[model samples]
Target: MKSKIKAAFNPRTWWPKAKDGMHNMSPLVAFFLLNLFLVWIKTYINYLVNFNLGVTGPIQNFLLVLNPIPTAIMLLSIGLYFRGKLSYWLIWIFNLIQSLWLFANILYYREFTDFLSFGIMGSGSATGNNLGKSIAAIIHPTDYLVFLDLVIILVFLLLRKIKIDRKGIQKRYAILTILLGLILVFVDFGIANVDRDGLLDRSFDNNYIVKYLGLNEYALFNANQTYQQSNTRKKAGPKDLQKIQQFVKENHSPANVSYYGTEKGKNVFVIHLESFQQFLIDYKVDGQEVTPNLNAFYHDQHTKSFDNFYNQVGQGKTSDAEMMQENSLFGLNSGSAMVKYGASNTFESMPGILGQMGYTSAAFHGDVATFWNRNNTYKSFGYNYFFSKEFYPNANKPSYNVGYGLKDKIFLKDTAQYLQQLPQPFYAKLITVTNHYPYDLDKENISFPATKTGDNTVDGYVQTAHYLDQAFGELMDYLKKAGLYDNSMFVLYGDHFGISENHQPAIAQLLGKDKVTDYDLGEFQKVPFMIHSSDLDGGIDHTYGGEIDMMPTLLDLLGVPTNNMTIFGHDLLSAQNPQIVVFRKGGWVTPKYMKYNNHYYDTQTGEELYLSKDKELAKEAKANDAYADKVLSDSDKVITGDLLRFDKRTDFHKVNKKNYDYSKKATLKALKRSQETNPSSVLAKNDGHSTTDEYTTDAPEYSSSSK
Candidate 1:
């Protein structure tokens, strides 16, 4: 037995035989293996150097290396069906395609912090405008390595050192290779699932998809997704639109008359609080309040805040929140409407609705236009102007733009320059990003210490929230001083949960609980939603609602009816609004019951109840599960089908995407032109002087010399 084992392992005995086998191997087999090896090496190299895949531990690292092999196998095997020179050229073409794909992702990841997707490719005009300088900026010498193997192979081909066989690979060998590749693909998928459960299903992150599955596999996945959505849209007709319209009509709740039109004609400013949760509203760290400005706003006499407000974002996350806020429509169950349907879908959005009333609408974000595909999405929402990263001064500077966007305080301060220039009664959305994930803050900007929870993710969350709070305070001061606060309506809301469920140990410590159960994680989805206007009555109302209610509630307050449009959310202030809180991942929470996956929990108490044990509880859970599923399915139909394009209603005009441009030069030039013609901007109201100068802050980055 020992001798047999030694014989099996010994390289001295097998080396000569193995070398002879290689020497006698067929040219077709050699060519296939060589291409496969080359593609695998370059993909792994690109993964390591160009992308931040968050690959952890040895298993995931092995899977990352293994993931690219099957794609090369499956792709290269196609040439096996042809003969001689034709087969060789076909194989070379596929290899070249893969080479180009890897290089494209490297450049895209540098600019967007994301991999290339069909969604992005379908809307190339957004990033392809300045193909010369824009792409050149992201290119580095190391990126050229993706084509190293191809170049070497080309050189070898030119020298005729390696010759292609005159005959094609046999059918049996080709079939076997494909079968082996398929088996390997499934094996890689199974290992990834074991490592991170629901990573393929529940994770909407492109980075996660590429990290778990190879770049080639992710492209295939996205291509399949794009084809399905495109086919669905193409097959859709007026009947599908009618079905969605009926659903919307039935789901709609009438606005509460007592609070309707309360802030009519007021300047509407939406502050998108990124990754902020509801628990932080009154949370205290040592002796200091985490969010003093938001806390005061929650209790201010002129504010209306909801303690039970929730965020109904899906895989889209922040973009989903924005989608629900703008159009009163739920985001797709799998991806963001902004990225997937933004270019094609027609919206009866907040901007378009207000635009009809002579309100010039704009959206403000401190990131590039391509992030979230907002450049085209905002136009579909009928926003006349979009002040993206290009509009900000020195936006490319590291200090100005950090962690996915410009620093919060600097963003608000600089936005004032453009904000004052906008027409009065304008609807503006300012998206804050300093409080985003990985929650890092500048050393000088840190006002609070990390929690002793020992979890780095949870600890950093507080300090970033503190910094975001400080930024919000600075903006509020500026608004008040500029005399905009008195007449303008301020809507501040937390977009989603800051800390992920993966850090349960740290979350348990932070919450002072013995254990953090699945129920607690679901309950953690609550986010702060507050509406503040100087003339309005303020109170902490215990109304249960989600991000979907934002648009309808605000429109209701402005006395705008939503009967003609498709809106999934109801006004929180309405007595008739349903108390059901729907989650994107097939979960629903009501005042009495909470349902997630196959588990049912008592809403007030964190007690899990089995459906087999209680008949009444089971009935309620079943009904909610069925209804929530229906609502989600119906919404998916509307979103994936682009059914709104079939609506020929005269009340809401179809958005002409050509009328707007988000580029800095064109937007500023158009703003100037508009101010001259309309003369309704705050700057115009102030006799051509800037009101943006009144803003001040204690933030370390604040400068008195700033606009």
Candidate 2:
């Protein structure tokens, strides 16, 4: 019995033993470590291939490299509970899931430029069917390396080179493995916290969460967050709505009568300039205008432009901008509004509100409706029509797209026919995508030489912005030829900043600044907001506001009172209230002072304020900072509580989703009904001929074909 007990704890003669002071690991534990080593290798390869991981510096790479230690220990501890086939298969399945999960995310991130969230994965069969070839095209040959461990293990088992250990690991050893895993986890947390304070709490950006804690931890965090939001919505009280409405009412800014009803009863055309910035309005590269057409539109006699308009975006970026502009509510402080609560939230949106004003609203985009989960969001917005990629011809071809979807020229031109089919005084929005990230262009489409900046992305931005500008020129010509230009309320706005702080050095050359200052970063956030109407007076307004201000401004300009609505933004044209633009991160911009990341700066001088020297400015900054934080918290309470559902506004008409459908049959039926009722309809007057063929451009894809 003594010999047998000795043999149970001893390593086999043929087994490799550790040096002094190191414990001899069991074979099962060794196997788990080996498998996890391969997983680490797979993860490193994935990070290398995935450009959007945006991994920089040695510390980040080191954190990712350290992931396998805790992971292997945890799995081994769990597997030790059973022996033989049960244990073997359990570990195998764990490895399989880990590998496959990474592979799937590699494909998903390539298309969406984001990590796959549990919310999107639960989006059901419609989303799966819509994936199409886009997901498949992004898979790399080396991506198959992730499954190599499975193949090797299968081969060994089939060749009888290895056998499953039937004996369970000793309890002490199993407990040791679990304790080791816990220790490693604590170590990881310490290291991560050293790098970024409250790493888990500041998970508003998924990448930040992944950077400090690791992908596995991020998945768990996301699941918890999603559950919390779901629970919050279920338990919400009517008091939530009362508080929100009261807050908005106290903060409301009455409109300027000068701009009120300026373009009332006119058709509304909202064109979203994707990834565009205000600096490109009249900027030149090598003496060539980068965006001449947009500059011309900005200076046009009837255009109302904002020189100080900022983009208020959170983790959702462009989608967040849409949420703010349409709903007049801030997006969730974390995750995307479109993905997190789009299907469930009760939105008093632009389209739905306009529908009550006898306006038929439609949305146009050249990507799948599920790209940002826009399809369901649009329906909830009470849109009469949604023209996604399915509505455009040849949108699936590679030649028609660069990054996200169809090129601007083709998207706008193809959309012309559908636009004319809408009833008079309709509301339509065109979302452009040519100037998106990793901006690449075909040589034939490139009109200007690349900027001399060393950064390729900066140089590419100049070229792509020019291309989109040229497309805008074609769209203008088409609208004029169709007699829809002068009569419409044309609103063109840049959705967000094209370049981030990482690209600031390259842009510094353009700004003629030796070093990028806080002022420069603040200025970079400015986006163009142009409202053009033929009969209205127009000029640049120096109002400090954000995307949230747009909805109230539009409603006010259309002669609608927003006294009963729940809106977070004040009208830019209203001087009754001080215009304060609150950023998502608790910073704020006001005309007198700018508070950013606990620092106060003078708005006019662009200099940091010394608290001792500028006591008055510091006091104002503290107040503004507190207000900004309150705004973010209040916005979260409203969205998470789904408070709008309890709104008691007598003028508000809740969107009836059952009444809307995006199917071709539904769109055709609506158009047919419009023609039957209104003889003055554009499509009926034109005898159903396509008005898009009139659009002429120098673009290589369409120039010769159309002319």
Best by TM-score: 2
Error of 2 at 332 (Å): 3.0
* TM-score of candidate 1 relative to the true fold: 0.74
Worst 10 residues of 2 by lDDT: 8-17
Report the number of clashing residue pairs per model: 1, 0
Off by over 4 Å in 1: 1-225, 702-707
**lDDT (0 to 1) per candidate:** 0.80, 0.77
Candidate 2 residues lying further than 4 Å off, grouped into runs, are: 1-116, 120-169, 176-216, 333-335, 394-398, 500-522, 585-588, 592-626, 683-694, 703-707
**lDDT (tens digit, per residue) of candidate 1 on 1-707:** 99966854453432222335552556767787889888888889878877767676798899988999987899998888777877777777799999999998887666435566665565455434433344664477888877877888878877877787776655656776777789999998898889768765455456667777788989888787767777898788889889878877887888888889989999999999999999888888787889887898889988999988888876567888998999878877455678878977877788987998989899998878887789889989999999988888868888766677788988888899888888888999999988876677779888797788886557888999988988898888888888788889999988877776656688788788988876887788899999999888888898888898898899989988878777778889899888888887556888888875436889889898787899998898778766676677677778888888888788878878888888888888988887788888878878888876587766565564554
TM-score of 2: 0.78
* Alpha carbon deviation, residue 520, candidate 1 (Å): 0.6
For model 1, name the residue pairs that clash. 303-538
Query: For every model shown, what is its TM-score relative to the native structure?
Result: 0.74, 0.78
Write down the RMSD of all candidates, one decimal each. Answer: 8.5, 5.9
Error of 1 at 502 (Å): 1.2
